[model samples]
Target: MVRPDGSIRVGTATVAGVLAGTVLAGCGTVGGSPAGKETSSTREQDTKAVRSAYGKTAEQDTARVTLRVQTSADGTSMTASGRGTVDLRDGDSVMTLSAQGGRVEQRVVDQVLYQKLPRSEVPGGKPWIRIDLQKAAERRAVGGQSVNDPVQAAAFARAIDGKDVTREGTSEVGEVNTTHYRVAVDVAELPDGATLRRQLGPTLPMDVWLDGDGRIRRQQIDMTLKAPAEDAATDRASSPPRPAKVRTVMEFSDFGTDVEAKAPPPRQVTDLTGTALERGQTQN
Candidate 1:
């Protein structure tokens, strides 16, 4: 796939849509009361209650989440599928990212320590690059953080705290009862240069749906991004441009318990200089 600036351009596929949905959930509002002391107090209590419920629910069940990402604009599209396993008690987790066509990236994490094994080209295929887990863990402490659905879920919870939140009623999502909450969040509240707001603009609205336990089960969001002007010289050098509007929707399901995930055996690393490896040179 096309690596833009050394980072994979998560294509405009279903998975990209989901990521966009997660990010958009951190912005704006939907017909909610104006922000005031009463509104703030109620929202604080509600958010605390929600977080408490989430903690309890998480303690009771294990989450095996699958993320589908699709990113598209202009005409190009890219899709990715990933799975995440989180053990809330110890904050240990494992996440694997793979292109449906074959490429696979795996990460094994235990709290502050993590290991990014390698980017395997295909199932049982050659390794293109290997990342030391110890090094990855250190880097994460310095600033690098993996982007996953569970992380996004946590961020959403944080965003709702002490903000202007309003209940939008109940709805059924995949046979589960969900209560919808709308909150207006300012992008400024997030760290500067957050990719979501920088690429998608700063002032959009999000609608979030929570199950009875207050866990976010679904979300709908709208975002407006500034893109290059048609008359710009280069695609990357465009001036303050027209805004592109996007809508995203996401749903989470199949909550279970005591899930155990295992990392695949390590693969032999290879150089990309066109040399074919001898048969017995493979590593387990």
Candidate 2:
């Protein structure tokens, strides 16, 4: 079995390369309105329409959604793809994701369990590991349930209450026509630890686009962070070193809403170290 670090190296390269190629080939230049052009009334109508379409009482039946996720870690320069499914009703939802590459596969059931180990590491050579997704989901969902930013949520709600909405414009995303909206919020009002703080400056700049029914089609956000100056002195003193920048992208479709997804039976997690131990005992 490959060493954990070695496996990570191989998997990262494969996933990152695939993501780069796809993004370049499929995501052509996005052309649309620049900032400061959209009218307030237009934005309001778009937000209202989306909220009305998705907002439901807690007792409402759940709607199933399958989304593709592509992630690139900045330090590792590796990209990976995963499939996520959400069953949402009212404000509650269940999310699951599965990602695989090389001799490794990982599954997160209901955003709770997170298990990853080598495929060849299992006792019987099973190529996957089981994790507890329920615990993981709860830890990550402490803030709220919606996928969008909390600030945006509050801004949207206030806009609806104040009868003000800003329509940014229209753009095409993969042949789908999407309407854009710019919901206003003060920079100081943003929640701490928001993605904006991680990506750009303290202020959060965002653009949200929705389909005709108010389903979020896409979102762009900008923020910043501080790091040691990249001078020679800083480099020599850096202990862990920085990771590479790689991005992954994934897409999912045709989720069978009627056919519910069932979790696999309980099993032990597997890894390269475990496989070595099992093989040694077998030799006796």
Candidate 3:
């Protein structure tokens, strides 16, 4: 199945719109300075600051992360939250989340995602389901998008345009004093920007908080899903409704922390890649 963002769904129990590879509860509004116009030079400076911050964050190689995802659709809304550690260089991560009155666990290593689900779902009562995102990507799954781990999700800041960045003054994330900025993500500049633009629209607004060291302390993206064109002009009763509105917030701390994400024991894992791919083909 396709996620709201068009990426292939990996497991049955997803928290909010994430968790297929990356994921949330405890999501709430964050207060910050109101957006203010900036001079051209200031805009350039802001862009440089964000880019440089991204570089510094990458250099740290590992960090502790807290995630909150809020979604609303068809008059229903839900929130999910989680915490985890990520190894930026190796693309490995381990996370545990609270959602739908249950606990969900996920691990990502070397492009493979392992999800630990309830005991009943597995054929042999295996606890973990394995999905190869690389295989899914190679298959050109219908919604066509890349799944990013928490660390890589921050890369979205790299797509910012100088003209769309506004310095929002200061705020504190956790105990760290930070500079808050409102940014417009130039979706076209991302690797999958073309597909995202077709699905999510031209530009996405974002709020980013950076510490004195220029590392991102907090970032949030509130996304509104566009209705399908074919369904747009049809009667609401006849056409399907649009997907949920998803808001994802990520907070980072403990940079340079050690993160070790190893694969689940083979006996406990059920390789679901082939079955998932077949099911996807049938749906498509």
Report the number of the highest-TM-score candidate: 3
Off by over 4 Å in 3: 1-17, 20-37, 140-158, 229-240, 279-284
Q: How well does candidate 1 score on lDDT at residue 145?
A: 26
| Predicted structure 2: lDDT | 0.34
190-216 in candidate 2: lDDT tens per residue? 444354234233433344456554554
lDDT of 1 by residue, 1-284 (tens): 31111111111111112222233223333333344535656767666755454455455455544444454555554554555554534434444555436434433323222223335322235543323222322322111122222333344455454455666656676667766676554554443325445544554466657777776565455556555234343444654334554544544556664445344344544322111112112200
lDDT of each: 0.42, 0.34, 0.63
For model 2, what is the alpha-carbon lDDT of residue 138? 30
Q: List the residue pairs that clash in candidate 3.
A: 19-22, 24-80, 24-81, 25-80, 25-81
Ranked by lDDT, the better of candidates 1 and 3 is: 3
Candidate 2 accuracy as TM-score: 0.49
RMSD each, Å:
9.3, 9.8, 4.9
**Which wins on TM-score, candidate 1 or candidate 3?**
3
- TM-score per candidate: 0.54, 0.49, 0.80
- Sorting all predicted structures by TM-score, with the top scorer first, yields 3, 1, 2
